[model samples]
Every structure is written in C-alpha cells, then in structure tokens.
Target: MADQHRPGTLGHYVPYLLGRHLRAGAWPPEIGKRAILVLLGLLAVVYGLGFGHMLGNHDLSATLRANFLLGLYGTVFTSTLLVDFVPSYRPVQRLLPDHFPVSGRRSAELAFLLDLISLRRLLLGVFLAALACVPGQQRVALLGVALLLGATALSFGLRWLLTWGRGRRHPLVAAYAAVLALAGAWLTLAATKSLTGPLAAGLPWLVALLPLGLLAGQVAGLGPQFLNRNLVRPALDTAESQWLARLSPEWKAYLRKTWPALSMGLAFKVFLLVASSVMQAKHGSDSSRSIFYLVFLPVISFTYANNNLYGYLYSLTLNELQRLGLTSRLLVLYLRLAVPVLLLDCLLSAVLLVALFPASTWPLLGLLPLSAGVFLALGLWGSLSKAKPVYKNLDLMNMRNNASTLMNILTLATAATLYFMPWWWVRAGLAVSIMLTAVVPVRRLLSNHGPQRRQLHHRLQSM
Candidate 1:
C-alpha cells in the first residue's frame, strides 16, 4: 500500500525521473541518440580500417585475430562495468536514480537491467557478431557472446560485493582483478607451452564462463538482502582515507597535490610493469627478450608519458600544480618525485633484462629514464611555449593528442632502427644528440615563468 501511495515509487517514478534527468539540460534525446549512433558508426569504421590493415599487410596470424576478438569482447564487457558499476570518473552519475527519491528494490532491479542490457552493449554485440560471420571465425563470434554474458554477470556480482556494499573495496577489487588476470595468463601460458596456440583459442570461452560460476556462488551467500543493497550509488570517497597516512611527508604532499591523477598514473604504471615482465618471462631467450624490449621501446617510453603528462592533463592536475609557481623549484619537485618511481621501474626492468640479455647489453636499460626525461622535457616545452598552463583548451587538447601520438610513433621507429644499427658509436652519437637537443627545451621551460610566479608566491604567502 505504501509503495503504491508513494508519489515517486520506482515503477511509476523512475521513467519520469529519467526523463527529467535527460531533459534537464539543453541536450535533447535526439542529440543523445545521434551521438550514440555516431559512436557506433565510428566503431564500424575503426573495425573496417583495422581489418583492412591486417589484410593489407597479409599478417593475419591466428594469434592476431584471436587477440583482436578478445579485445573487442573485453571492450564491450569493460564498457558495461564502467557504465553501471565502476564508480570512478562516471560522467552520467548525475542521471542515476540515486539522486531521486526512488525505493530500493525496484531501483536496484531497474538499474541492474539498464546496466546489463544497455544500447551500447547491444550495438557492440551486433557489430562483433557480424564480424564473426567473417569467413573463418564463427567460433570467435560464439566466444564473444559467451564472454559478454559471463563478464557482465561476473562484474555484476563483483560490484555488488566489492563496490555496492562497503568501504573502499573497489580499489581492492581492481587489484584482485589484475592479479587474477595475470594468474590466468600465466596458467594459459603454462598450458599452451606458447603464448599463441590452440590453448589461446579455447581460453576466451573458459575465461568468460568462469565468471558465471563465480557469480552464482555469491548469490546464495548474499541472500534476499542483495536486492535491498544493490541500488547503484557513488563510490565511497577515499579522498581522506588513512591508507596514505603512512607515506612519507613529501610523498603525501605529492599525492595530495596530484590527487586522482597521480593515483591513476601509478596504477597504470604498475600494470604496464607487470605486463612487460610477464612478456619477458614468456620469451626466455636473450634475442627474443632484446627484440621485445626494442619493439616496446616506445611503449615503455610512452608509459611514463601517459602516466605523468597525460594523466595530469586529463585530470586537470597540471593546472593545480601551476598554482605552486612554475619555477625551477617546481621542476625539481616533479623530477624528485619522478626519480623514485623511475628508479623502481628501471630496477624491475633491469632485473627482467638481466635474466634475458648479456651484461654488456645492460647499459641499454639507461634508455628508460633517458626517454622518460626527454618526454617530460618536451611536455614542459609545450606548456611554456603557450604562455598558459598545459592542456588549456579544445584546440590545444586536440593538438596535444595528435602530437603525442605522432611523437610516440616517431620514437618507436627510431628505437627499432637503433636496435638494428650495428655501429656502437653511431648509437652513442644519437643518444648524445637527443639528450643535447632536450636540454634547450628543459632550460627554456624552467626560465619562462613570468607573472605566474609572483601570483603563486603571493598565494603561498597567504597560505
């Protein structure tokens, strides 16, 4: 009776509430629908271009095809998790029923269905299914369907337990997923005897189906209270969590100033490190490991760039740092913070390299920090040249994205060439020339602090 009497009960109110949320702003449903359509259209174009590239190169290895399919499946599954459960950086948080006066059970069910059966997911499924109809990949299509169902269900249950119910569990859940993925990859490698083989073919299905079983296990334990508890809400704010209390004062300050950007970068960095190490372990031979390192030179270089510059800019953390005065001190602060992490990465990578390469080739490990430094210098150069802070506007943002991508490609091409170059002196000359070229930009960026410093000094004095 109370449910029926309630003015905004889930059944009667949710649709209206959703309508209000959608129509609240200038953006109309047609615009939203058109945006979604355009996005799907772009996905189609991307798939076509990717397929054409593969065909053009005549490089359609089964491993490449399998990995591409798996990536698509993972993308669809990740989009679901991101839309519904993962509370980090959600753009649509304002539109959720949590903001309204809806009752719990109905809201939970509706949210669950909406998250599970989203239009984006459906479109992606249709796209992938059509791709599977390609000459030799019907099984891949079936596997994709199976993965979508299984990963979505599994993420659903995981979100209920790790994200929906309690304190700061989502981060732990992410860590758990990373570890689980690595373990699974290790198991697959062990079973297959090679990274690419028949085992890889069946692994995707198994990976997808395993989650369904995991989801089933949680339901009995969760009981009826699950419905009452499952309504999607904002992730618990860990801004003031004590987890970082034990960090050194400098580290704490760095994290406080950087906030989510630094945290995200660190997570990504860790994942890259793990992935690189795993690949190194798989390729036991010295030549293979050397080649792997050379091939991924740009990747490792860009990992640092992505974590630092990209993350800071995207999260608007760089703007925050600009308030501290863009003087030599600020530059030093960044380098000091970077050095510890860079050293750690270098050490881990060196350990992997040592296991695979001769001691003489060990000097090449210096390239990690060297290239990272070069990119950081380039980032500073770009920032200073604008006379404003980094990542300021749409046009600049587009320029930055394109420039960063082009830089990465050029860096990769150069690294690959250097790897094949026989003359040691030539490699040394190139390295020296690159470093020397970087020095001018780094120096210019450090000195170009005009009015910003005076304002920043006053702000600091006031603080």
Candidate 2:
C-alpha cells in the first residue's frame, strides 16, 4: 500500500504530441535511504570527536587554518572527482540518459544532486578542520570551509559558462584545464615550501575569494554530452578495427576492461608504498608488510575492480554460452593472466622495499614466491566460488563484484602470520600451507561448475 503512493524513476513519461517537457526527477527509492544518510551524518559527528586531538596537534593559528583549508579542499576535490567520473564510467549509466531522453539540463541537475549527496568527504574535511580550532589559528576553521566552498562554486559556475559557448569545446576545455593546472601547481609548491611562507600566509584565503564575482553570475547548465565520454563505438564502427584484428577474439571480448583494474592494481601498490614510506619513519618496516603479505590485493583497490581476472566475470561465455565450456580452460585462462601481473607487482614492491630497508626486506625476497603463490591460488578459488557479472568499464560504485569480507580477512591473516613469526622460514611454510586451502575449491570447480556459471550470467544483461 505504501509503495503504491510513490512516483519512482519516471513513472510518467510525456509523449511528443501531448506534454511539452518530460519529467525526469528520481526520488530516493525508500525512506531507508534518507534514514541511512541521517545515521551516517551522526556517525561522522562521533568520528570527528574521536579524531580531534590528531588534527589539532599544532596549535599555531596559521598552521591550523592552513591545514583545515587544505583538508577541505582535498576532500571536496577528490570526492568531486569520484562523483563526476564514476557515473560516466558505468556502462549502464552512459546509455541510460541516451535512451531515457532526459534533457541535458535535467541530467546535470540530477548529477548535481547526486554529487551533493555523495560528498560524504565533507565529514572528513570537518574532522581535519579541527586542526585550526585549537585556540591559536589566525583564521577560523569554519570561515576556511566557507571560503573553499565558495571557490568550488565559482569554479563550477565558470566551467559551465566557458563550455556553454558554441562550436569547438576543445579549445575551451584546454583553457579551463590550463587554468586549473596552473592553480594546482602553485598551490602544491606553496604547500611544500617553508611552512611560514604559504602555510601561514593570509594570501591563500584571499585567493580563494578570487571567484567571488563569478559565483554571482547565472551560468547555464550544459548537457551530458559535455559531462560524459563519447559513446562506446561498435567493433567495426570505425577504421580503428585495424587494431581489433591484432587482438584475439577472447582478448577482444573481455579485454573486458581488465587493464583498468590491472593499472589500478599497480596504482594501489604505489599508494601503499608511499604510505608505508611515510609510516616507516615512525613504525619501521612493519608498516610495509602489506606490500609482501597481501599479494591477492595490494589494497581493497581491486576488490571492486573484479577479484577474478579474465572470464571470471564473463563465465557466461565459458560456461553457458558456446556449447558449454570446460572450467579448466577458463581456470588456466584466468591464472595465465593473473599470475605474471600479480607476481610482478609483488616483486617490484619487494625490490623497492629492499632498496629502502635491505636487511629487514631480505625476508620479503624469501617470502615472495610462497606469499604470491598462496594468494594467487586463493584468488583462483575466490574468482570461481562466487560469480559476478562483467562490466565494460569499472566504476567506483558497482554492485556486480565478487569480493567478500572473508577474502579480505584471509588476506589480512597472511599479514598477521608473517608479522608474528620471527623466523622467515616458518612464514614461508605457512604460506605454502595457505596455498593448499585452494585445493578443495579447485576440485569442486573442476567437477561441478554449472551453478557458478549460472551465477556469473545472472542478470548480466542488465549491466
């Protein structure tokens, strides 16, 4: 009875002859959506209270203000990127507006609403802004937040204004990009320079106000053509088919957007390496142990990128399609790709760590084969035991993922075992034992994989 009253996802579509404009607003599906947001907001407040001391460590007014503004800008900037880019990457999302016939202005409005809701990073910004509130900062943390928001608004308005012009958007895009690049470069240099120079300067706050006039202007909304990527062309749609011949049918099939994950997997390792380096000064080599132990994933990074490489997502092809396929061929196919890439990641990460801490990292070299093997085997099992649909491009928000909490826990256990064991030999032995756990799953997959094939294919058409 309650559901009947709600209008959801274009309950009313006007025909060309009847109504003048189409109604495109989408409401939250259920009351729980708003309830969850309320709970999250409350949780963020509690979290902020807990992290207050770390933020406010430096009591100087200038230091605190600079740090707060920096955190806010970083949060909004990064979160904005995710909101703007993630939706466009989703295969379904790209085609939705195209088919749905939502006007560009309506699409932009919806995007803005989603962007506002997805700005959960504002919570973290507030938490870090506590840095400026410890009684010594020259500028108020609250005021700094306001300034950043204003700058953000002004930038957006200007971006829309510049791009809304006729003809070539390329030149306009280039000019916009150049301005942002210059601004970013200057800010980066200033932050890295002596603290008293830019960190304590009042100039940054004043500079944030540069867009005040633009903020007052009424900017017209642009269409999704301005926001999203050009449509994914069919294989033979263009002359680019020259390169298509070079790739095998299988590669052409799933080349299934795996490189993005692989590239991201490497990026994940790089980030961990940087984090470990920062923590190494304080916690020693213990911090970087993740680089060695968690070979399945360097971070939670690739979990969404698809835990199972290759046909794991497209098991529909190997299993149900093409007169039913063998699991071994699929298994071999998956491992064939996953093996070298992950091991290389592990090796490169180890080598870099070794260069940093030669004596401590030598164990990483010894543990490399065992640790990498164990996770690779586990990844094989993980990829098969549960199935998820394939997508053209990976997005930050995707429902069709095979990753589970248990897998992450098991990966972490590898770190814990290596961490507690003083003897490097014992650690390698444990990894070998861990590798054995994949045997049962491998046997099951070899014998009876029909259910998994079905699972992978389930609702795949919707994606």
Backbone clash count, each prediction separately: 0, 3
**How well is each residue in 232-345 modelled by candidate 1, as lDDT tens digits?**
465435865566766865566544534343344444445554555566457543424444554324344233243233233323334444554354655554566655655555
Where does the lowest 10-residue lDDT sum fall in candidate 1? 389-398
lDDT of 2 at 427: 79
TM-score of 2: 0.66
Model 2 poorest 10 in a row by lDDT: 17-26
RMSD of 2: 7.9
Compute the lDDT of residue 163 as modeled in candidate 1.
42
In model 1, which regions exceed 4 Å deviation? 1-103, 114-127, 135-139, 164-243, 246-326, 356-363, 369-373, 386-422, 438-463
Question: For residue 172, what is the lDDT in candidate 2?
Answer: 42
**lDDT of each candidate versus the true structure:** 0.50, 0.50
